[model samples]
Target: MADPHIKSKMDWLDYVTVIAYRLGFTLAAPAILLLPWEVETGIPAQQLTFLAAMLCASSLHIYMKNFRLILQAATWGGLICAIFGFPLFGLGGAFVTLGGLCFKEYFCFRVPGLRAQPILLAALWLALVLNATLTAPMVVQGLAALSALLFLVTAVAKWRMPLHFDIGDKTKYEV
Candidate 1:
């Protein structure tokens, strides 16, 4: 059976978010791999690559969609090793990228009416913070920490909101 949650015609705003999410990932993936190479070659390359990844991550926030952006960002960060290569910028990208994924997952749970296991949520937060601490600039560490903090706070705030999520008016939790 086809998934009922799939909307036939996505709202224009939703479509825009999906496109932005894809573009962010497209630019982010290669930059993640190439950024570290910049270090051996020169800081110039590293800076450029980091800039690309950062732009992608920054752009993705507007959409709030769990699209290609998440995997691409993670792939890029993995290629570079979370907290090391091109300086704090690389590390910050890692945090933003992974943190974005974590946020997306939480948002998904809200709609799916699925509660994430507490341990899983904790691990996600830890992974992001650890990655940032290892690869990001000392100055960026604070920013990354703040970003992580924001993710947690936002998730909690949304959870407390009186909003009741439904898959669609047609479907109920019990089939």
Candidate 2:
């Protein structure tokens, strides 16, 4: 009889994954938003964020689904592009993965405001990528801020959840 309180190696890994994901988003949001002082830090926040995203995806326990692996691949693609001097393309790909994760969270946990996250993020990304004059800068910033808030709420909620919530039933996982 194993002690229920005794966490396995996988359990510890899950906690680490959640921590990395949450911290990555927490830092990446401000950095990408061009918050004051982020520029001075001179750190590659985007690259680090994508790396954390990849770790999160790798540790995700989506039973009977390859979607998690797909997300991981996207993060890798984004990271590679970012490292090779294609920051825009890398950011685009990484944001897509982030949006996907938000959608997944919304689908699974029904977090408030998350349902609109992907759309808002996509619109913001498109506006920036296309340099669309049709959409005002204020609107773009508003969307980014909103998306960040939604992510913050979701991350906080997830942080409060037990590790098992993320790990789910190991029995159902594909071998």
User: In TM-score terms, which candidate is top?
Assistant: 2
Global lDDT scores for all candidate models: 0.41, 0.64
Instruction: In model 2, state the lDDT of residue 89.
Output: 80
Candidate 2, which segments miss by more than 4 Å at Cα? Answer: 1-10, 35-45, 48-52, 132-135
Clashing pairs in 1: 83-134, 83-135, 84-135, 88-137
Question: In model 1, what is the error at residue 155, expressed in angstroms?
Answer: 25
TM per candidate comes to: 0.34, 0.77
Per-candidate RMSD, Å: 13.1, 4.7
Query: In candidate 2, what are the lDDT values of residues 76-99, reduced to their tens digit?
Result: 787788789986687677777777
Query: Cα deviation of 50 in candidate 1 (Å)?
Result: 5.2
Worst 10 residues of 1 by lDDT: 164-173
